[model samples]
Target chain A: MNRAHSKTKRTAFVVAAGLAAVTALAACSSSSGNGGGGGDSGPVTISYGVWDDTQGKVMQQIADKFHESNPNITVKVQITPWDQYWTKLKTAATGGAAPDVFWMNESNFATYASGGVLANLSDKLKGSDIDMSNYIDIQTKAYTFDGKVYGIPKDIDSIGLWYNKALFKAAGVAEPTADWTWADMVAAAKKLTDPSKGQYGIVAQSAPQQSYYSTIPQTGGQVISDDKKSSGYDTPEAIKGVQVWVDLVNKDKVSPSLQQMTDTDADTWFTSGKAAMIFEGSWAAAEFKEIPYAAQNANVAPMPKLDQPGGVSNGLGNVMSAKSAHPDAAWKFLQYLGSKEAETAQADAGIVIPAYKGTADGWVKAFPEFNLQVFVDALKNSSQYPSSMNSAAWQDPIELEFNKAWSGDETAAQAAANSAKIMNDALAAEK
Target chain B: MTSQLVPPVEQGQRRPTPLPPRGTKRRSLRHGDRYWAYLLILPTAVGLTVFSIWPAIQTFYFSFTKWGTFGGHEWTGLDNYAQVFHDPELLRSLWNTVIFSVMTLLGIPLSIGLAALLNTKGLRGVGVYRALYFLPVVTMPAAIALVWKLIYNGDTGILNQFLAVFGVDGPHWLSDPATAIYAVGVVSIWSSLGYNMVLFLAGMQSIPGEFYEAASIDGAGPWRQFFRITMPLLTPTTFFVTVITVINALQAFDLVYLMVGKASPAIEESQTVVYLFYAKGILQGDGGYAAAIAFVLLALILLITAFQFRVQKRWVHYE
Candidate 1:
């Protein structure tokens, strides 16, 4: 027993020693943020950070292409999961150790730009062949702060109606067309629903972008005022937009219950043949095309309109860090990332719609089986995804209130009014 | 204990009287030895001061401020704490945490029973049974979460399929707000079984076999022997396990965060205190509010520990 005790102690010591060595080695490797400036005559490695793992492969290809042009500069593509990307980036920026170039979302770019964490790219826009008019107006305008461009637009996204052709055929319902209206969607959903067979026409998730964001404007409502000072949830149009799904899930029985949707998301519901229809973004096309069921049965259409053809468009931008050691090298990579060459690579991958104008056709052609062009067309009348200085602060409250409405715990009108109060307070606190 | 003494020999000699007037030079060889020990501990001391102590101080200071974007902050007095006090969700989460701790404490008795069964005399394949029970504790949380998610899924989960044998349909375990916290609690108990049972087994084995033999000769049945002898003897282990389990359960986040997920409808009820802090601090970029939540948890733990110490006197028998 004594010998065994000593043996255990010895083993524990060895393990501790091993862990310390590994930690030291890891720290040494991760502290390599030196290669940012273009002054390095020899080989220099710059970090290019991205969030989506799917799009990272194409970004890596872009890096390779750029390397071919300027062999002295090396771009290392780093992919962090989207959920943790901003949090990790915030910590890195605080430590003065952010990536040389990183992906930025419009909702968050303002906060970082205001904090002086993003580099001003006005000079780059002026000097380079990258024309301001080449990209979508809202996207370019989304990344601008203090009338200066802080980031170059990467990809533009718009919501679309994804429906299963096989399900529609079996139900004897016509597939959704470009001219489908809100009433047409509800009618088709009712006809297609077969609840006794454990199938629903759609899965109405507690999702903002897919459901409320698109439908709100179509019903003629704004999520926030033009000055971004107050909430629009209290408006009759907004309440109608939110009530559309509540009525579908609870009253019409054409959609799954809120609990079921929470257990398995709408995307999974649509993919598994349980749901005939779902509202999804263009970014989902790549994933859906990969799934055999969706690949064969699923196709896209523009989000159904009510009074006018309207949807919500959001985009990602590529920005250089303000504290980058190699600012010139970082800027060069940023230029290449936003160029037609990089956009073509992204389009050919069919993962996302490049924000670059006239390059969306390649994305549509990449997935010829699906009607991917509906997303591009939807962008023509889409509004910017509603954002403020700190979006998550209010987004969380709105979602929480909306969940109650979705769960039938509160009336849509009541939930909308309560959400507006919370949103207004958050907006007031932002300044 | 040693006494400080005046030299009585100084009275016998006048020359010694001058030396007695001054302080005595008492020699302790162990003191010099500890100097070398302090040197040995210097590295650890420095590491703790830099990593642990500094962060604790910062968390306290930041609790009094509002975190601005990009790591900047401004002094905000007690506004964060005021918000924390007024935030209904924070209160709800605290209540949820308390419920989780109490539910998980139920595992203590269940584990003790399993430990006794494993410790049965002449039991065959004891090692195998121990390993089987211990597997969940060793498994990765993410993998365990996925497996449990599949089992708890309402549509096609094996649990509901089993319930269908009785012509019953189980609720959506991880998604339904009514059952999500309890579902997570069940997983928590299953995971904690090994650690608690090991402690109980160690406590049981240390008990003298003669006590059981004596009890048997006095016409005590096996059940009586367990209740009278084993229970009292295992008190210390029970006390230790109880305190540790309470602390561990109060800080519960991983299972709830993984199983219920952020998008689940049950998140409102299923969120543990740490999960709330994570959302506010890490996800929402509100570090000051997060710091305040951390301190509230810290204060709660201190109070519970004090109460446990007071209650422990009634049960734990050190001898």
Candidate 2:
């Protein structure tokens, strides 16, 4: 009995020893528990968070330029992938330790803005050298709420029909023009498809910004109502828009199945030369130009015309945390980020379309090989990326059922109706 | 769980007595060793109370309220729980987790078989064999899942390519609702086999060699010695492995997150309760719903563990 007792006691002591080491390490953290993010006025290394790694070089250049002028403040660029960025930011903001400055998008803007986590930049911009008039109206409106601006436009993104000229030439199909209609696109896709090569003519992606979002609007349906109180997914026009992709995938067999797209994404299929065409964002130009085949043969044209001509217009903004200790330094950094010089740098990299007016020339010339002007031309007739407060509440639920339509388990109308019901509940919850 | 690292004292022919009840009339630690013991344990107790127990209380409180953004919430008694009960997706995920736990239990016996084979007398090159089996346990699960995803790919994977030689067509394993859950279960079994085998090997090594020799001398063959001696003696280790494996399978998320991502068509069939909690809490920003899901999972695990403890009295033999 005494032996077993000694054994238990010995085990306890060993565990206690291990835990002691952990506690000592925990105590070694230099800062106390209650210190906030960027809570020092001394030489500070402010974390500048972004989602896209393709623009990491340009971001570093921007940071270097800022360091040269400020000399005391330093910025470190932290890249979190797009899929995890919002959730990570949400957790940090809820814990009251959000990064000083980070990228923001319209899809996730209202949640943070209305939650009082974002710093109001209206006062900061009032006396700043950055001209608000130089920025696009749509992007400025996206970053504003109740007469308070919480974000400064970083870059704009618009979708275009990126196609392979070599494939079109090989298939004896003419290259698509800016005024091409939906029928012309279908015919070209049919002509370009080569089943023996294990290749499809087009990849009909389910991506909101690149595919159905633009197509729905072109078919004379708004994703969100003007009052932002209702979803138009239940409308016949919206059903027709969704049906376009379904037909391309299941009926015509010109596009890969939904399952295939899930395995290897549309972007990969296009860049790998397995798909002749794709609806891609302007930001992908930098990534595609890195690939040899795509760099040589890929070119862009405006999204084809249907009942109406449009594409999804989305832009990213730089937002400051309301809880930042160095709000003045953060504002100065944000102002510099929105300056014409920073936009020019972003333009020369061809990573993204700059939101500042008259700065798209360098972006267009960055890739002298391709017709990059298509993205800028599409923006003229573009619609805003649809979003309301708590957009994810409905967006997630809708996608849960929407995939069934793409997989041919349900008709487009049924999916749209189900989507509308769930979307309405989410929209109602936002109020 | 206490570690098996320490050598257990062999008390002859007497079962272990349960520790005396606290506050009993005995020479309690209150007299002398209590202070040192308290000092030794102070750090762990404080860490648990602050990090674990405190957050549990907060999560419980949040379960009763609907959260907006940035810690904003309003009291809505039992509303979130009501939503959870009515949610079909939650129920489906719970069922999948149950199936996942039971399916993963298949690894326990497989590991025992490997452990016994390696325990063979004068086994040739057993160390190389053991290292090969333990590789999966040491590798990162994300990297494992990524490679498995390519192998399971429908159109161009090596798995389908291999199956083609036999004139067999393989379904899209990770994308098909009928196959995705089973595929995930198979991977779970593969990944956990090494860990369970190590535990059983430790247990086997602790057994005295004379016990097996005596059984063999009584005209018992190798299979008889295994069933009569090794199996009965290994009950305690088996119990621990079972409990740990059950808990791990029930809390599975990493493999599901990596293998069948959110875009997969088979998510409804393959997602676990924890994935639902993540989607609702972090992705959808519904903290109340997520808290409720977590409490439900806790209740389930608690009941299952209690039932296991009860069932162990029938089979688990204590020295």
Q: Evaluated against the true chain A, what TM-score does chain A of model 2 have?
A: 0.90
Candidate 2 docking classification: acceptable
- Over A1-431, each residue of candidate 2 has an lDDT whose tens digit, in order, gives 35456456544443333332222222211121223354456777777889888787789899889989998788888898987777677777877777788899988898889889999888878778877778888888888877788998888888889999889998889999977998899999998888899789999987777767989989998888977899999999988888888888888889988888877778889988889999998888888888899999899988888898876789998999898877777777888899999988999878888889889989999988888888888788887789887788887777767788888888989989999999988898787
Q: Candidate 1: which stretches are off by over 4 Å? A: A1-39, B1-32
lDDT of 1 by residue, B72-154 (tens): 78999999999999999999999999999999999999999999999999999999999999899899999989999889988
Pick out the ten consecutive residues of candidate 2 chain B with the lowest summed lDDT: B1-10
TM-score of chain B of each: 0.89, 0.90
The TM-score between candidate 1 and the true structure equals 0.91
Clashing pairs in 2: none
How accurate locally is residue B201 in candidate 2, as Cα lDDT from 0 to 100?
A: 98
**lDDT tens per residue, model 1, A135-252:** 9998988888878999999999999899999999998999998888878999999988886888898887778998888888888998999878889999999999888878988888
TM-scores for every predicted model: 0.91, 0.90
Give Cα distance to truth, residue A65, candidate 1, Å. 0.6
